[model samples]
Target chain A: MGHLILRVTIKILFAPIILFAFYVQFHGDYGPGGGFQAGVILASAFILHALGFGLATCQKVIPPNWLPAGMALGVLIYAGTGIYTMLFGDNFLDYDVIQPDSHHHAGQHIGIIAVEIGVGLAVACTMLQIFYAFAGREPEPMDDAW
Target chain B: MMLAAAASAEVGSEVTPSTPEVVGFTGAFAVELCLLALLAATAVAMIRMRRLFGVAMLSGIYSLLSAAFFVALDAVDVAFTEAAVGAGMSTVLLLSGIALTAKVEMPVSRTRTIAPLIIVGVTAAALVYATIDMPGFGDANAPANAYVGRAYIEQTPSDIEVPNVVTAVLASYRGFDTFGETVVVFTAGLACLLLLGAGAIRGGGRNDDGEH
Candidate 1:
């Protein structure tokens, strides 16, 4: 029951944070928010969860073993966008060249969004992984337990 | 020819704001000052704290306030990066390091601290003197604004089609720097993994039954 209450409280806190992260990601073009802010905000939610629920439960949700893979995948996703642009016959990171149609503006938007998502994923995962690496050490069992 | 073209480009563009813009500018300036004060307080706290956790938390606050200052300065991308790398990732890593070592930082000795104090004093004085000759905050016609920024703003849209100036500067004009930063992050991760060991065994040991 205590765990259930904690889960509900976390859910309530998490919903707004996720909303803010998305806002930072998309609204960055107009204001002082962007991929980095979104990534940190998203990572903070997980960090808070880990702090409250113990590292073990947090690991169940985001296993430490998969963190490096997630980080690498995020970087690959970001770089892949530039690679895609190059493959499409433009210079690296040339968004317009990726699609090269009348709706080139749309292409730019899509490319930017894709790259931001990649950044957010990489940052969030790396942060959580770091926390796991540091706080994950188990306490030695007491001999008296036997 | 290239020099003439560059000179012409410099003269053609400048960020001249109107009356309402001035009001907005003043508002931003006030916000920037408040954030700077907050950052200073955090730095002071970090320096004064003997507990490692307190110092780590203060450093995170410093990062967050610096991010706010960056936003006020219209460097959104930098603000974002600082908030993530500094406040989010670095704090976590520091705390992790603390977990491996002592929670409380050793108190500074009166005997050993004099050298550091003198060094800090000298550095601060030098920085203050350097700032005196700097162009006034947000001077659109300053050399930094006139040369590199103007060139990028005018030229990058035609080339890259991205509207965000920070994005253009980071991913296009100074792309190599961004790549280097990414490499640094990758290296930090590698170092943590190597020094700390595998992620699974970090927080605690698993039993023979495989329970964490």
Candidate 2:
């Protein structure tokens, strides 16, 4: 069937992109890869899936109502890290001061990863949501003046 | 502080520095130049094309080529955003708009062609002139790296504790800019929602019957 072939092709194309995204996120310290690039790559993979499959299928995967919540959650996670630092008797986003007794270096790395994950989540979800919104809807008519 | 530590380590390294193999730089340069030429050619083609859909697709290619240029410059974040927004989102929106209006592009007139050509020529000349006195590409010790970037590398870790300098700069030192960017994203979402909501309502009213 047409749907089966499409699904197989989609999986083939998407698997590598997802793997590469994880590589970019983790290997950013060594080279030119980072959270943003990883996020976009992941988002593009999903957008491609949405394009190939029907918009209804895409909606089932990422419902419109869930998208706003995801975006807010991502922003909150990022802001929450800063708030944690602030509450621990330091300036906002001062990860070194997170835990005075523990090794500060470990804490800093944890904090950076947390924030990067938040950014990645926000960007990926927002991009997919935008594509869904645009592609799922039909167009309006032109003005009657003509 | 990390950069300084790295720099100090570099000073005492026993290994001799050598250019890492980056494929064929000449071939890469030739390909990049060809892409740039293709971008320009496509822009002209888009203008001359009689079909609006073709123009939109050509413009999308132009955006993608610019994104490739950004990647070649090692600006991955910018390239990501451009590929998503400019190439992906804008093209979709433009096509949707065209679907709502006329499907064909308006015929080009001599008056329109002359103005755009002159504008493009003047802009290109200015850019060429500006690049003449610029430092060579990828110069590590260029003014950009020496001054503006140096401060962030030196001070941010001690203060913000983020190993990634770009993240530290965007989220902490330049937090206001990030805030502004968030607002821009929110505003765009709001505008799209409003516009799309109106369209949906009108579409529904027109199609009260279940039949297409």
Candidate 3:
């Protein structure tokens, strides 16, 4: 009964929080935020969910198996972009040549976005993975104690 | 200082108001000082608090204050990261830790506390002394602003086409460093997973150290 309000509030908030994370993620090239901040923002949303809904419930939604795998996948995406640039006979991570005939760093735009997304995924999942390791080991504490 | 920022922003709206005014530090140094004072007070309170839970909360407040301080210095990106990671995520993580452990910190002996306090005081005094010689905020003639930092600010648009120079530098100019940092973060997470085992992966649930 005590959790009814928290559950409702989080339910209301969950979507917007995720949306804002992506906003921060993509908006970095133009604004004051980027992947690290956005990733933490995204992870906090889930962490908040885990707080309200209980670890087991949250784990069921996200699945613990995806955490470590997702972490490595993000790193791969980031490094893969770098490696892809290298394959094109360009210096590593030199975005200018990634798209041969593009005008004025169009390739750079593509590269930064891809790399940022990779960073976002890696950071978000790593944070969640760490949270699961910490929060998963124990049952929910007594509601009043919190 | 915040009051002045708000007032000036209002005045700015009255003029060429197409764009909102940047939160400038031109006349807001006092606000930064006040924020730093609040941060110091919060840190002191955190130390004095016996309950680990209370300390965690105070530390979160300290993070928030410092985030505001960062904003006053025109480091919006840093402030954003600090607010999210320091104030938001770390606070929640600390609480999760407290839930797993004891809420109250163990009381230390009076005599034992004195030695650490003296060490902390001396270190802080030294840091303060060092700060006295450091360049003032936004000092263009300072080494950073005068040299490579200025070059980055000048070259970013031409080199990367990113409006946010920090992002341009981080993802492009400093691409190798950012890649290394990502790898480092990935490695640390892997190490943690190896040691602790992701909750469900190890034991089924609570008290699931497996051997038990």
Candidate 4:
């Protein structure tokens, strides 16, 4: 029989973990979090799900095929922001000219948020992808064979 | 930067002709010491343990203690990162790796162990010597505090206008550095995928056993 209690517990806990990750992602400007922490937090929920259920079950939720896209997209989003700033005649990743003729704070704020989103996506996907890789491998005989 | 300015103002108000009271063996210090002791114990236990499973758990405990210590030091961001990466990701990864190999640690010859011990001893001594020249804790006159730190604190409001100085410094002032770090993280992930992702990433069956 499945560990029904553990399964139920995971089911109940999943949404809140994702919610908390979003809160950390956005609240980073005021508090002690950022894209890095948020992304890890987000991916960890899936890991937890994998533990409670199984890898195959978790893969159904977040397909292994899409993980590569998630990983690359994050970098693209981040570098794209820098490239956008350059197009505006500003230094690479410079937020001052992101929203030209607008409030500098607004520009800076938007730039930070965008960059953080990119970071969050990259981190979350990479972590989950790594988990998939490690978990998918079948056990092998040790070299000593003791 | 408002938060940062308030902090600077608070620090300014505390400065007086009288010398500031030195923090002694307060409760926080006691907590810090306890965490440090636990961390050291965990590390030693992890090293000594023959069971790789227990070693992985102990390492996770070490990371947890380090995160607690960071929180005590008011570096909540660092603590958050430590808890996420070390406790969350690394422990899981290590356990997965252990599943693919022997649970018991391979016995090494005593002679082979001596080289690592001497290396660690020499490195620890050098680190202790390095700490001797460092400024005392909370020393406002410290080079990092007296100049660049203050400039960031004061100018953040006028420049990027983010309230969290750490965020402002990381995201705006040294944004290019953060960009590079993101790319590094991406590169590491790509490398891992390249190495271990064949079975998982390919369309159908995985592993030598051909489990899909």
Candidate 5:
């Protein structure tokens, strides 16, 4: 429980993991990763902290209350983007009409980024919530007492 | 087909006969074969292992191997997801689940095995049969490659102007489906919260040494 190596390694690795997650999120348009992968990567960093330290410490960093809201807000952001385009007289999720000022390709780029952020938020929060649920449980005592 | 392509590339020091494409395919085939062998070994070990913790760890290894296979198959996005979700998170979650319950599985009754084996065997045979009719992997003439897949590939560069066609298709072309996926994730989180209802059965057994 008091493994210094694990603690130190996690502390060193945590920031870089989150940074890579952000890179994966934004660079997805030009690279292999996207929101789903980025989100899971982000959540894994937090989960690693939870594993090395305790659940309480992890919860202090990412309060349980924030998770559900973050999950909903992400979905809302995605749906809201679609609705915004629709209100602008575009078909559902038709990114071109969202910004009349830019070229249609530019508009598509903007739309993709916006939605990817939404997906990232939702997936990350969902993973954390599931982790909290499982990790927070109290294990029952074993039988065969002396 | 990929093997055939690679084999046809004559190896000559003076000629440099292997095209880049053929060399790439050959490298991919080797990587895939290695990963598959590791995956099979991990699965066999998992089956032989009785401890739930060991099984959980083996499954994580299996996921990592499959992620490598995904990379060899040129599905980097899928590889990324598999490595993160399947290897990273699910293993931790499974260990937690094991912690809450038992570390070892109960021995199964001998009579209960036959029906399940028959069912699984038939399902496997059926799946293998189905694959016989399916097109060879990466065949351009395949039905999957014919219409929608072809359209996505052809249109993504011009229409979305993105280097990553997977992201362009997922977020832009199929935005509605992705929106649905986000909602599904949201609903799953909500369901977990509803079922667990944060702060249930507090301060029970052992105090965890670090338990709040």
Candidate 6:
């Protein structure tokens, strides 16, 4: 964490990792990535930052207090999308009713993107929250000879 | 399902292999074989190593090797998940676990290993026997290939208008399952918070109890 090169490199990589996560998040409709992958990628950026700068600084950037709420909020968004569709008189998660004035294609696209973002948010927050729990436990300093 | 699709696609491409195609397939298979071998080696090393750090490193290597295998199978999405989750995130978690616990595994008694060995051996045998009943790798006439698989492939463009069928199926057709998965992840995060994370906030972040 005190190493200057590692800290500087992590600083450089942080933006790109989050950018890539977003790319994968939105590009799922066309490519081989989706919410889960994007979420993990996003979490990895924070984890890398934590490893380089220590947990306190990482938590300063993404406070632990918000993680649990964020996790729940993601699932709420997903379930809310389903509920919204159901309110339109369709079956649970049926996208055809999402945009009553438009064709099924547009509705499906919109619904899928919304749910994907929900998934990404939930997964990202959950991963970070779990990491915080693990990293928070203090360890006895070990000999570095190994 | 993704693995099945990839295997079938690979088989379909292999059917018309010119010299170049054959060479390419052969080279790919060779790479897969090497990766699998390395994966096995890493697993063995993990088991033999008493040092938790070495075991952690070996397990990360194992995950990376499996990620490579997933790529060889043309399951790029799965490979991405395995690389990120298995190799990347899990490694960090395991290292954190070691920081909380012992750096070396305690030596086990010979008698203590017998039951676990039998259980593992039986499970392995059962899995192998189950595979014997499965359709051959990439068989076009397999039940999955004959039914919903074909439907998804054929109807995705028309029905969902999504270029990625996996996304369409995950987010739309099987939306409930994904919702459940999200909830499960949320629950796990919450559980971790309640178990270990809550203490720090309650204790004003000092951890003065001297317990990990």
DockQ ranking, high to low = 4, 6, 5, 3, 1, 2
State fnat for each of the candidate structures. 0.31, 0.10, 0.70, 0.72, 0.72, 0.72
What is the fraction of true interface contacts found in candidate 3? 0.70
Error of 6 at B123 (Å): 1.7
What does each candidate score in C-alpha RMSD? 9.3, 9.7, 7.8, 7.8, 7.9, 6.1
Better of 2 and 4 by DockQ: 4
Candidate 5 C-alpha lDDT tens digits along B1-212: 11111211111111121122344557566665566667656766776677999989987887887787767667798888889988998999889889888788777777886776566556555555655565656678888789999999998877889999899889998899999888888888788767764552231123344455
A1-146 per-residue lDDT for model 2 (tens digits): 12888878987987897888787776654445555566667777776676577656656666666665666676677778878888888877666666566544656666666666666666666665565556646555546535
User: How high is each candidate's TM-score?
Assistant: 0.76, 0.72, 0.87, 0.89, 0.87, 0.87
For candidate 6 chain B, the 10 contiguous residues with the lowest summed lDDT are B12-21
lDDT of 5: 0.78
In model 3, the runs with Cα more than 4 Å from the true position are: A139-146, B1-27, B202-204, B207-212
Q: If you assessed candidate 5 against the hidden native complex, which CAPRI class would it receive?
A: medium
List candidate 2 segments past 4 Å from native.
Answer: A1-7, A26-30, A100-104, A142-146, B1-28, B74-101, B116-119, B151-176, B198-212
The predicted structure with the larger TM-score, 2 or 3, is 3
Question: Under CAPRI classification, how is model 1 graded?
Answer: acceptable
- Highest TM-score, which number? 4
**For residues B1-212, could you state the per-residue lDDT of candidate 4 as single tens digits?**
12222322232222211123346768876786687667656766777788989988876787777788778767788899999998878999999899888898778878887776666566555555665566666678879789989899899988887788888888888888988888888888888878774787763245664553
DockQ of each candidate, alpha-carbon based:
0.34, 0.26, 0.58, 0.68, 0.61, 0.62
Give the Å error, residue A31, model 1: 3.4
The global C-alpha lDDT for each of the candidates, from Candidate 1 onward, is: 0.66, 0.62, 0.78, 0.80, 0.78, 0.80
lDDT score, residue A91, model 2? 77
Q: What is the lDDT, from 0 to 100, of the residue B211 in candidate 2? A: 43
CA shift at A85, candidate 5, in angstroms? 0.5
- Could you tell me which 10 consecutive residues in candidate 3 chain A have the lowest summed lDDT? A137-146
